[model samples]
Target: MEIGTLQWYPGHMVKARKMVLENLKLVDVAVELLDARIPMSSRNPEIDLILANKLRAIVLNKSDLADKSQTEKWRRFFSTEQGYPCIVLESQLGKGVNNLIAAVQELAKDILEKLAAKGRKPRPVRLMMVGIPNVGKSSLINRLAGKGSTRTGDRPGVTKGKQWIRVGKGLEMLDTPGILWPKFEDPEVGFKLAVTGAIKDEIINIEQVTLKLIHILSMKFPEALKNRYKLEVLEEDPSETLKKIGVKRGCLISGGNVDTLKTAVIVLNEFRAGKIGRFTLDELS
Candidate 1:
């Protein structure tokens, strides 16, 4: 299986990092949103390290699109092995949001307690939500606030600025624009993001990404492609499988030839949107 590669970080990402750093002092904790399908790949390691001293909670957004059992495995893995509190959430349906306030309060309990002990009026736990582009940051904020409080679109770089959303009695959230690292050191991480729709398709080759996705699915979840597209699994040439999907889906040319490029887009879109089924591109062994 091949991982997708990404090149180029837009100007907005650079600006977002600075903005987040400038406002870091205002927040008590950080809620990092990650796509459940590719948790490791979707994370910005540099930003995480920079915010290391702050109380952090990982919200595995888009949990509905990922395998439920695997999601639980990841939750346990983060909590037990990594010592980070992790929650699996579905922003679209508003699932697992009620626990967000409680989780944040628990993670920042020490800070809150220390303030209370000093007879200082305990301030609301300030939380900053951060993540890479298109990782459901806005959607999660909207879900947490119980309304469409933030502008959300399918494309990346949609949340341009910062906004504070009050979640509960003593909790507030600062929504930050999505940020990507300066450069993707590991090409696999870039590819996973591209395959999962975190990266803009215009900057990437959809056909190439789709082929790589097919290769990964062929090994990790072979039945996913077979069941979703009803195409025969091929061990030798994966392009043949993509062509078969194109033929089945009627993505064809005027002369009745398979349009592999069109088929690639359909497959990639379906997989990213969960039409293919609940799946995770990466797994912990």
Candidate 2:
């Protein structure tokens, strides 16, 4: 399947764009959350235009699921090259929650300082959290608030409306619905998003996605595939490799034929859950 021909911008994403624009005036800073595994692909291209002139910071969420060294390189690329304050975060575990908080506070300091100079009362830092679907925006908010303050799920578009939640005495955040652009510029970007669970499984061909993943793992992290699936040797063809995995894992029908669909789901779920291995699909270069 050609990923370029696939389009997933639904009506809700259009609403999400309008919602962000409407709420832009209500926030002091914008925190863009990106998947640590595919930082370049998971970023919303429209964000730069929407957040122009606003204090912006990048949070590489789900850092624990990505190669630690690659995540660091991405952080430096965004911070040093792109001029966005970047922080690596494991939102599910709250590993870098404090660093995110500190980064936001530091970015908002100038806004607060100006208010102080005018002898106006200080206000809590208002933050706008934006990202592509399933990039861990809601999870990060929950971690920052230290509770399930916002709705969260493994699938995309879980948070349909905006919600204001107080994280601390001096911090509050506006959680918006995850947004995707009308179209993807690169088909490879779509593939990356599909493999990473940012796109709904029902929207894409699961078998093709699994084969693509197998191909990538075979080339980049062959050990992960071999070790996780107990394969002594990998087949050059991903379909053949998948069948071997299905047979080993006992995904078979009455005729003893491997259920490739079931096997695909298992592999995709395990990959997203970090059971396969820590990997970074996007490279710095």
lDDT of 2 by residue, 24-68 (tens): 777888888899999989887777788988899899999999999
Residue-level lDDT tens digits of model 1 in 38-75? 88888777865668688888889999899888788888
lDDT against the true structure, each candidate: 0.78, 0.83
Per-model TM-score versus the true fold: 0.87, 0.90
- Candidate 2 — which residues are off by over 4 angstroms? 1-5, 9-12, 147-163, 175-182
Clashes of 1: 1
Name the 10 consecutive residues with the lowest summed lDDT in model 2: 151-160
lDDT of 2 at 3: 39
**Over 4 Å off in model 1, which ranges?**
1-6, 9-13, 147-162, 232-235
